[model samples]
Target: MDEVSPFAEVLGQAIYQFTLIKPLLPTYGHLLVSALFPIYIGAHASLSKPSSAAKSPKKSQEDGYESDTEEDESLGDTHKMESLAPSDALMFPLTAGLTLGGLYLVIKYMGADLLNKILGYYFSQMGMLFAIAFLKDCFAVIRSFFFPRKYSGSGRIWKPKPAERVFQGARDDGSSSESLEVRHSPLPGILGAIPLPHTVRAALWTCREVAYWRARLRIHVHRLLHAECWLSVLDLLSVAVALPAIGYFTFVTKPWWLTNFLGFSFCYGTLQFMSPSTFITGSLILGSLFVYDIYFVYFTPLMVTVAKTLDVPIKLLFPRPAGPGEAPDTISLAMLGLGDIIIPGMMVGLALRFDLYLYYKRKGMHKAQAQGNGSDIVKPVYQSAMGGWGERFWTRSVTPSEPELEPPYHDARSFPKPYFTASIVGYVLGMLATLVVMQIFDHPQPALLYLVPGVLLSLWGTALVRKEVHEMWEFSDAEEEDEDSSVTDAETKEPVEAGKQVSLFSRIFSAPKEGSERPPKSDEANDESVDGKSDKKESPEKLELFTISLYHPRKRETSKLKAPTERGQSPEDDENWALVGTAERDAEPPAKRLRRSPRQH
Candidate 1:
C-alpha cells in the first residue's frame, strides 16, 4: 500500500471512486491495477482464491487469500454481527483518527499538489495508451462482425472451397450449432503474391505460415516479460513475505544486488520473438513504476511540504521552465531525510529477496518430484523456440544434454500476455518499434513512411493472433483439456462473486439477457442526487463561506469593526491596487473613520 506506483497514484483518484473490485479501498485500489502493474501479476494473484477445479495454481498460505475466504464467510453471515466484540471496534477509532490526521498533515501541512501533478502527467499518458488499445480492439471487433468474409482468413484471397460446409462453433461431425461456411486457404503458387500493401504482404507471409517468424516473436516477447515480472515479484515478495509471516530483518538486499533480473524478461522476450522495441518499451514503463513506488513512499509528502516551505515549485529542482504567474508544483527534497531513506529502503530490499525465495521454492519443488512436471507445463522460455512435446520428451529421456533445434522452445512465454493482444498491439506499437530501431541504428527517423510497418504488423497480428487463433493448440493438447476445465470459466468469468453472494441487480441486469430490468439502484443510481426536490442541494453553509476576524490587541477599536470587503474590496475605502503595490489603511475606530469619511465623500 505504501510503495504504490506513481502511475497508479495518478490514476487511482478516478478509479477508486468508481470501481469496486477491492471495495474497501478508494482510488488506491485502482492504482493497484494500472498498466505499469503487469495485469497478469494481480490477475493471477486473484486466481489463488479457492477453486472448485483442481489444476489451477494453489494459493500460497502467506498471501492471506485463504484466510480471506473464511473471513468473508464469517463477515457475510448476519448472525455474526452481534458477535462483533468491543475490542474489534476499540482500535477502529484509533486507526481512523490516526489515518485522517496523517492524511490532513500530508495534504494540508505537507503539500499534495506537487505529487498530484507529476503523477497526473504519467497517468494521463497511461489513459491515452489505454484508449488507443481500446480503439484498436473496437476496430477489430467491428471488422470481424461486419466484414467476416474479408476479416476471416478464408476470404477471396485465401479461400479454398471445401467439399463440405464448415458450420463453425459446431460439432466436428458437421452438425450445426450456428451456420457458417467452411473453406481453407487456397495455397497460392510459390511465385504468386497477394495485392495487399507491401508491408502487410510481407508480414502476412512471415506470420501466415505458422512456422518461423510468427511464433518466434510470440516466444521471445513472453520470455522477456515473464522474467521481468518475476524480477518485480521477487523484489516485492522480499518485503511482503518477510514482514507478514517470517520475521523480517531491518536489512534485506539480495546478496548480488545488481538488478540482472530485468534482463531475464527482455532476453526471454527476444528468444520468444517479441519485438525488441516492445521488450525495451515495456521495461521502461514498468521500471518507472517500480521506481515511483519506491519514491512515493519515501519522498512525495516530504517533497511537497518542503517545496511549499521553500516557496519554490518542487519541479524547479529538476530545473524545468515555469510559466508566468503560475505557482510551481513542487515536491520537497527535504522529505528524503534519513528516516525516509531507511524505512522504505528496508521494505524494498525485503521485497526483492522474497521474490528470489519464491523462484527457488518453485525450483526446489520441481526437483523433489521424479518424473518432472509434464511436458505440457510451460517452461520459463517460450514454447515456440523448441520442438513440440514428443521431440522434447524423447530428447530429454534419451540424450537430455543434446540440443535439437537452433531455437529450442522454452516452455514459458517470458512475458506471457494474452496472445491476441500481443499479436495486434504490435501495430500501433510498431511505430514505437521503428523509432527505437532508428535510434539504435543511428538512422534517420521515418515519418509517414514508417507507418507502413505498423499497418503491416497490425494485419499480421490480426489474422494470426485473433480470438481463437490457437496456433499452439495442435502442438499442445494440454490447452484443450484446460479449455474444458472449470478453471477456465472461473478465470474468464465477469462475475466477481467467488461462490459467494453476488448483488441481485448485478447478476440479473448485467447478464447478457435480451432485456433485463432488475433495479434502479445500480452504480448509475448511486451517482444521482440524494432524493427529494433535488438529488442534492448545497448545504446552507456551502452556498457562501464567511470569514470572521477578531481583534484582541491592547488598543481598543470599537468603530474599527467593519464588514469584510465585498468582492474583496471594502465599500469604506475606494482604492485601486497595482502589481507589487500594497493595500494599507491607517488603524482607526469605525466611529472615527465614519466621522472622517465626510471629507473623502
Candidate 2:
C-alpha cells in the first residue's frame, strides 16, 4: 500500500470495501447527495414551523382567500380542505426519484464531462456569492465587536403587536385576526406619455404583470435563502452577473482551492436554509441522521460509493501530500461528504440563534423585574379603542393569589454566538477524531459519527450545566396553535343559541301588512333634510363590503336618490336598502344584537 501510488492504492481499497458491502446491501447510494439530501433539507425546513413563519405571511394570505372562496362555493368546505400530511410523507422519495432520473438522463446523453462542467459552473458561481456573504459576515462580526451599540441597534426584539379584530367576539391574545382589502386605481405614471418602441413597451408591461406574481413567490423563496447581510437591488444585479463569471472560471481553470472554498460557501448556504429551531427537533433530526450515517457508512458501502461516483463538489476535497515537484491534479484527494458539514452546521446555527434569544430575553426580563414598584415584574396595559385618550393599565394575573409580570417572547433576531462557538469547537474536535479513526482502522469512517456527538455534547451539555435546557429545547418564534384554537366547537354553541333566539323574535314580531302605513311624527317632517345629509355623510363608513370593492365618490353625487325600500329596485338600490335595514336593526337592545344572526349578503 505504501509503495503503490496513493490515488491507485486508495481507488483499489475503495473498490474492495464496496465489493464487501455490496453482498450485504439491498440498494446503491446514487441519490444520496443528489436527491435525498435536498428533500430532507426541504422537509426539515417545512416541518420547522417557527423558522418558516416569515414565509407564511404570503401563504396565510393565499389560504385565507382560498378558504373564503371554498366556503362560498362548496357546502363540504371542511372536507375539501387540503392537508400537507401526504406531501410531507411523499416529498423525499418523489424528489429523490425525479433527481436520480434527471441525473441518469444527463449522464446517458451528454457524458460525465458535461455534468462536471455544469456542476463546476454552478458551485463556482455559488462560491463567489458565498465568498461575498462570508466577507460581509466577517466584517459585521468585527464591527459588532468594536461598536456594540451599532450591532444592538440594528436588530430590535420581534415583539408581537396586537391587531384590531374584525371579529370582536374572538379572543384578544395580543394578535389581530383582521384582514382588510382596499381597491383603488393605480397611480398615474409618466411612462404612458413617454414614447418608446412598441416591443419594449409590451416587454415592460409583461414584466410589470410578472413582477406582481413574483413578489408573492419571492416571499417564500426569501425565507429559504435568508442571508443575514443586506443587499440592495443593484447589489443583487451585480451578484447575478458575478455568479456566471465565477462559474466560467471554475469550468475553465478548475482550481482545487477555489473549488474547496466554493464547497464551504455552498455548505454555509445550505446550513442557513435548513438550520434547526429547538434542541428537541435538532436532537431528533441529528440523532436519526447519526444512525443513518453509521448504517450507510459502516453497514453498507453506499456512502463511500456515492462519494466516489459523484464527481461534483457535493463534498469538500482535501489534497493528499506529495513531493514538492508533484502536480496538484495528481494528488489523491481526501473526500468528506457535505452531509457531515451541513447537518452539524445547521444545529450549530440553531444553537447560536437560541443562545442569542435567551441572552436578550434574560436581559429584558432583568430590566423589567428591576423597574417599577410591587412584586409584579410586568404590568400589561390594555387600551380600549372606544376611549378618547388615556390607556387602561392592569397587572396580568399569574394565579388566584398573585400577579406576575410577563417578559417578551424570544425572537429570531438574536445571534447564537455561544451555541455557534460551542458547535465550532465540536466540529473541530469531530474532524480530528474522524481523521484519527480512519488512520487507526485503515478504512473510511462516517464523519457524522464523530460530528453529531461533538455538536450535541457541546450544545446540550452546556445547556444542561447552565440550567437553560428547557428554554433552549422549546424555543420558537411563532405562537402556539393551541391558543388560536380556543374558539372551538364547544365555544360555538353560544352563536347557535343566539340564532335560535333571533328566529323566535322574527316569528313573534311579524312584518307589517302589505297595505299598512304608519303616521309620521311632527318632528320627522322637519328633520327629513337633515337626515338625508347625515345619510350622505355616513354612507361611506356604513357601506357593507363583503368582498373587495371600488367605489367612486363622484358617482354618488351624480346618481339620483331613490327610495331605499322600493320593491322593484336595481342592485345598487338593494345594497342601500340592506344598509338602511342594518342601521334600523342596531337601535335594538345590546343583547338583541348578539341574538340576531349576521345577515348574509
Candidate 3:
C-alpha cells in the first residue's frame, strides 16, 4: 500500500482515540455532574431564607421594599424549609436499615420481578411530577441569570403626558386644579418635522394603533397565562415536550440518557428541599449512612440486589464496554445510587452554608468595629432576587439609571466557598477511588465508605487549619429565637442592653417585683433631653401613692357612667374615670380609700 496522506493519518488517529474514550466518557461525565450537585444546592439554600422567617408584607411595605416571601407565596410553594436534627440523624440510619432488611426479605422470597413491576409504576408517576418541576425551575434560573427583575421603578421609560404636566404645573404654581385643553401632535420627532403627506400620516397612525393593541393583547395574555396562573409560555411549552419525553421513556424506550435525566432531576429535587441544619448534624447523618452502606453491601446482598432490580430513576446508570466474546449490540452498565450522591451532598451543602454564615458574621463584626461599636453588629439579611410571577418568564434589562442591588458580600455564586470547595474536592477523589477499586477488584464497592470519610475529613481538616472548629461545630441554619420567649420578653421587660452579659438564672429570676425599682434606662434613652440634662424625677413616696391609687378596685356600678360623646362607651372609659378619681383618693390613707364605696361617688 502507498504511504497514507497526513490528513488520513490524523483522521485515523482521531477516530482511534475517540473510540477508545467513548465508553469511559459517560461514566466520568456523570460522576463529575453528580459531584457538582451539592455545591449548587448548598449555595441556593444558603441564599434563601425560611418562608416562615420572611418579613411580613406590611413590614416590607413600611420599609419601602418588597420581600422575596411575597414571590414565594405567589409561586404556591408550601414546602417549609426543614433541617435535619441530631435526633433525625440517629433515626434515619435505623429507618434505612429496617427498610433494607424488609426489602431483602421480600426479594429473597417473592423474587425481583414482581417487586420491580410494582416499583416501576410508582416511580414513573412520581418521576413525571418531579421532571415537570425540575424543568420549571430550570426556566426560572436561566431567566433570572440573563434578565433579573428590576426594582425602584428601574428600567421603565417616562413619557411625559400633557395631563400630568398640567397637574405638575398647577402644584408648582400653588393654584387650584384646572383642566387645560391639550393639543395632540399628529406625528412626533423627525416625522413631525418632515411634514409627511396625509396618506402617509394616516398609515402611520393605523400602524401605531395596531401596535398598541398588539402590546395590550400580549399583556392580557401574559396576565392570564403567567401572572394569575403562575405558568409561563415557556413553562407550558416545556410541559408539552416533557410529557411526551417521559411517556417515551416509560413505554417506548428506556435508554440510558433518559434514565440519567430523570435520575438527576430526582437527586436535584431531594437536595433542593432537604438539608442538615448544622455541620454536626450533617456529620452524624453521613457517618451513620457510611456504616449503613458498607454493612449492607459487604455483609449482605440487599443493596446490590435492590439496585439491580429497581427499574426506576433511583440510581444513575452508565454504559460500560461489552466484555470479550459479547455481541457489539449488547450493552453492559455500571450503576451509582442516588443515596451516594445525596448523602455526601447534604454534608457538602452544609459546608457551603457554614462558609456563608462565617462570611456574613465576619462582615457584620467588621462593620460594627468600623462604626466604633463592636457590640452593635447585626447579621446582614440575604435578599433573594426572585419576585412577581410575571418576572419568572420575562424580566426587563437593568437600565443605567437603575443599578442592580448588590448583595452585602456579593452574590452566592461568587462568594468565598472554602469549606464547599474542600468537601467537593474530597468527594471527587472518593468517587475516583471507588471507580479505581471497582476496576481492579472486578466487584462493586460501597461508595459511601470512601465518600463519608473524604467529605468529613476534608471539611474538619479545613476547619482545624483555619481555627474555626468551634464555629463550624456550633453553626446552624435553624431559627434560634423562641417565639414564646420573644413574646414574654416584649411584655415583661425593657430592651436588654446590647453588650451587657446576663446569666440565664438572672434572666429567669430578676424580673421586677410590684414594689421594686425598675432597671435604669440606657444612656441613649436618658440623653434624649434638648440640653442633655436628665428629666425631673418624682419622689419615691409620691410614686408609691400614685401606684397604689391606680390598683384600687371599683364596682360594676361604674359602668352606668357615660361619656359626653355619643360613641359607645368601653371598659377603658370606666378605667379612665378610675384614674381621674385616683388623684382625689391620693389625699386619703390607703385603708380609708379601700373602705370607700363606688355608690358614694
Candidate 4:
C-alpha cells in the first residue's frame, strides 16, 4: 500500500479521513461490521469446511484469529452455533463497546480514510460470506416447498459410520411402503442474515422468543375479546402489505422523508435475514428507500452528523499485527435514531392488521351472500364454491372448474404448500402498511426498507400449510384404503433398467465391470423345479451395477480355531476365512469353490 506511485500519499490521506469518522460509527453499529468481518468469514468458512484448513494456516495463527470462540461451540457442531446461551453472545458486543473510544486515537496517529477502506474491504467480504449462506437457504426453501423430489438411493454414507435409515419399517407389518421424505433444516438462511458473536445470536434468538410471547399474548387477547387474533393470518397479511410498500419505496417514490429512513439502516447495519415473523416486519422496512438509493445518497453527510452527536470515544482495543504503515480503520454514521427501522416496521404491522380487517369483512360478505342465495356469482357454484378454479389463482386455468380446484394430497408434509402464496400477499400488504404508519408517525417517507416486513410476512402464511395437507390426507385415508394402496403400488415396481445415470465414487476404485452390489447370498436361494432337471440361474457378475453405500468398516470375522480373545496377542490379524463344512465342501470341488445353483446344466 505504501510503495506504489502516488499510492502511499493517497493511502495516507484516506486513512487520515477515516480517522475523522471512526469515532462516531459505533453508535450505529457499522463499526462492529468493520471489526468482525474477517473473524466472521474465518469462523463461517472453518465451520462450513471442517475438513479443509485455512488457506494460509500460519497466517491465520499469526493474525491470532480463530473463527469460533471455544465458548460459542456446543451440540450443533457443524451447521449451527447455539446452546440458548445468551452470555456467550455478549462477548463481541462488549469488546466492541470498549474499542470505540480508541478508534480516533489510532486515526490521529495513522491516516484516517486509509484505515477505513481497509476495514471496509473486510466487512464487505463478510457480506459476501453471509450472502452464500443466504443463497443456500433460498435454494432450500424452494426445494422444500416447490419442486420437491424423492431422492433415490440411500440418504448418505459417512465413512465408518452406519448409513441413515430413511426407510424405517419392513415389508411385513406395512411400514416399508410408507411415503416419507426427510428434509434438512432451513435455519441457516435466517442465521446468515444476522452474523454476530455467539452471544448476540443468542440474544437475538432470546429477543425473538420474547417477541413471540408478545405476539401470542396479542393472540390471546384477540381470542378472549372475540376480536379474531388470527396470528397466522395477520402474519401473512403483514408480509403482503409490506412487499408492495417495499416496491414502492425501492422504485416508485423518493420523498424528502426518505433520508432519515436510509440513514438509520446504514447506521445500524444488522441488516440480514432473521426468523420469518420478525423478518417480514424487517423486510417491509428494507423495501423502503433507505436500503437501495437513499443509502449512497446520504451516507457522507450522515457520517458528519454521527461524528458530532455520538458521545462515546473511539479506540483500538484489539490492534492488528501491523505492516509497515497499516492503521485500523473504523466507521461512524449519522445518528443513533432508529427512524429507519422503526417506522417501516410499524408500517408492515399495520398493513397486516388492515388485511385481516379486509379478510374478515370479505368473509362476512361471503356469508351474507350465501344466506341470500347469491353464492353462484363468481363462476360455477360447485367449482367456485365447492372445489377448483376460484380457490387457486396460482393454478393455470383459462376457464373455471365446477368442482373443487385441487385434489388434496395424502401426506402432511406434501404439497399445495403452507403459506407461501399467502405470505407473498402478506409481504406486499406489510410494505403498504409501513408507508401508512410512517405517514401517521408525522413522517411520510418512502424508503426501500419498507418492504422487508412484507417479505417476512409472506412467509407467515406458510405455517398453516402443514395442517391443510394433513386434513386432505385424513379425508383420503378415511375415504378408501384402496386409494392409498394404489399410490403405494405405483412407487415400488422397479423398472427393468433402473438407475443408469447415477454412479457412486467408491465404485470407481473397484475393478471395472464388477457387480456394484451383489445382494446377500440368502436373497437369491436356488428355486426347486417340479421337473428333475435344474434351471439355469443368472450369475451374480451379470447383475446390474447399482450403488450400495459402504459406511461401516468391514470387520473381518475370526475363525473358532484362530479367534483372538480379549487382551490376546495378534500374530497378523489377517481376516480368517472359514472353510465350508465337509458336507458342503464335498458338494463343490476345491479348484473352483463357487456358488452352485442346484446343478445348472
**C-alpha RMSD values across all candidates:** 35.3, 20.8, 18.5, 28.5
Model 4, TM vs. native: 0.21
The digit string of per-residue lDDT tens for model 2 on 20-99 reads 54532322223123323332232222222232121111111121121211211221101111111112223433443456
Residue 454 displacement in candidate 1 (angstroms): 2.8
The global Cα lDDT (0 to 1) of model 2 is 0.43
Tens digit of lDDT per residue, candidate 4, span 1-601?
5557688888887687557535433432442333223222222122211111111111111011111111112111233211111222233223333443355455556646665555544433443334333333333334322211121123221110012211121222224333444322211222223446666645543432222221211111111221112122224444454345334444465232332322322322332211112233223334433443244224423323333333221111222223234554532122222333333333333223223222333333454465575643221111001111111221222222332222121110112322334543553464445434543453323333444445444543343443433321221100111344666555533332532321222223336454433443232333222223222353434321221111211223235325675647352332222332222223333322222223211
Query: Quick one: best lDDT, which candidate?
Result: 3
C-alpha lDDT of all candidate models, in order: 0.27, 0.43, 0.57, 0.30
Q: Which stretch of 10 consecutive residues in model 2 shows the poorest summed lDDT?
A: 214-223
- Rank candidates, TM-score, best first: 3, 2, 4, 1
Better of 2 and 4 by lDDT: 2
Worst 10 residues of 3 by lDDT: 214-223
**Over the stretch 243-342, how does candidate 1's per-residue lDDT look in tens digits?**
3221111123311111112111222222211111122222232233334334443444533343334321111111222323556684211111211111
Q: Which runs of model 2 end up more than 4 angstroms from their true locations?
A: 1-111, 117-241, 323-329, 373-418, 477-601
Model 4 clash count equals: 102
| lDDT at position 478, candidate 3 | 65
User: Roughly what TM-score does model 1 have, to 2 decimal places?
Assistant: 0.18
TM-score of each: 0.18, 0.42, 0.58, 0.21
Per-residue lDDT tens digits for candidate 3, residues 422-474, read 98889988887787677656688999999889989999999999999998886
